[model samples]
Target: PSLSLSHSLSLFLFLSLSRSVLSPPASLIVSPDRSQFFEYESVSLSCEVQGNSARWRLKRSTVFGERSDCGRNWGKPQGSSCIVSLIPSHSGVYCCESGSGEHSNAVNITVHGDRVEEEGG
Candidate 1:
């Protein structure tokens, strides 16, 4: 019977591509989990998404290295979180992408400088 209808259409296209490659993408969370920062303290970068309505972007890299785009769109409410505020060059890696694009897994920040040293022996 046409080889069992070509093996049931190749097992329904391998179970619809294994359920769309295991289906899991769209969730971002960033907290002060040792992603160090200092200097005029005021740092908050949060992003979370599960399904629909997500837009958050903040990029920074200085201290002799250049990268721009401090903010963009940034709209996420209803349980999710999106907050941004950090100065002192806003050093190093920070990433968050959504709106169906799905990208969030790079949070390395280090903004130092709160020096205080004056003692003579």
Candidate 2:
């Protein structure tokens, strides 16, 4: 008894699909790379997705609400990276997400200061 050619091809495709599905998505890397910061410090983050084509943006979460995109006012968007000035309000968990919803691991950031967090909206 032997396997048919179609069956072998189908098995190969299944293995490939399983590997892709099991692998993690893109990764988020921080520049000045520590998770701790003083107020007004500049923080930079970039996404590390293999073969990614500028389809991702930094997504953030804080105490006041659900997650949201790091907008232009928060920082400058250059290529696949974002540079944000750390105000206390900017203290939160940050991650990368493609517009299509693929996500990377989250990074927790803390801004040390006495000032109250202001509106990020």
Candidate 3:
């Protein structure tokens, strides 16, 4: 009986480790496949996983030190994709994260356009 219990415990640990090894982090897919954009342009980002894509959400960290999630403060979430309107101030790093705390690879996006400012005294 002692040996049977010990073997069962070992099998449980091995199965746990195997599950972790079998699941790879999701990947972020950017439509239009470019990192640079002009003002007024829109970008679509999606999360690619082996199973369900709905488990992930888009996230962004702007150059101004602001972080936002899709459908929360910035992009519009459409199904498994997030659509973002581009502006010069929207340049930042974007990625996908799952509710289980799994993070995908990140991409850096830069918006290039004129920033108009009035001369101040």
lDDT of 3 by residue, 1-121 (tens): 9999999999999998897677656889999999988788999999888777777878899877998888876778888888988878879999988889888889999988843432232
Compared to the true structure, candidate 1 yields what TM-score?
A: 0.28
Per-candidate local distance difference test = 0.56, 0.81, 0.84
Question: Compared with the true structure, what per-residue lDDT tens digits does model 1 show for residues 2-62?
Answer: 9999999999999888864675344345555557666655555655534453365444455
- RMSD (CA, Å), candidate 3 to true, equals 5.5
| Predicted structure 3, TM vs. truth | 0.72
Off by over 4 Å in 3: 1-23, 114-121
Comparing 1 with 3 on TM-score, the higher-scoring candidate is 3
Clashing pairs counted in every model: 0, 0, 0
- How do the candidates rank by TM-score, highest first? 2, 3, 1
Clashes of 2: 0
Q: Report the CA-based lDDT of candidate 1 relative to the real structure.
A: 0.56
- Over 36-108, each residue of candidate 2 has an lDDT whose tens digit, in order, gives 8888889888888877647877889887776777674476787778889888788889998888887888999
Where is model 1 more than 4 Å wrong at Cα? 1-24, 27-38, 52-79, 82-103, 115-121
Question: Could you tell which candidate, 2 or 3, scores higher by TM-score?
Answer: 2
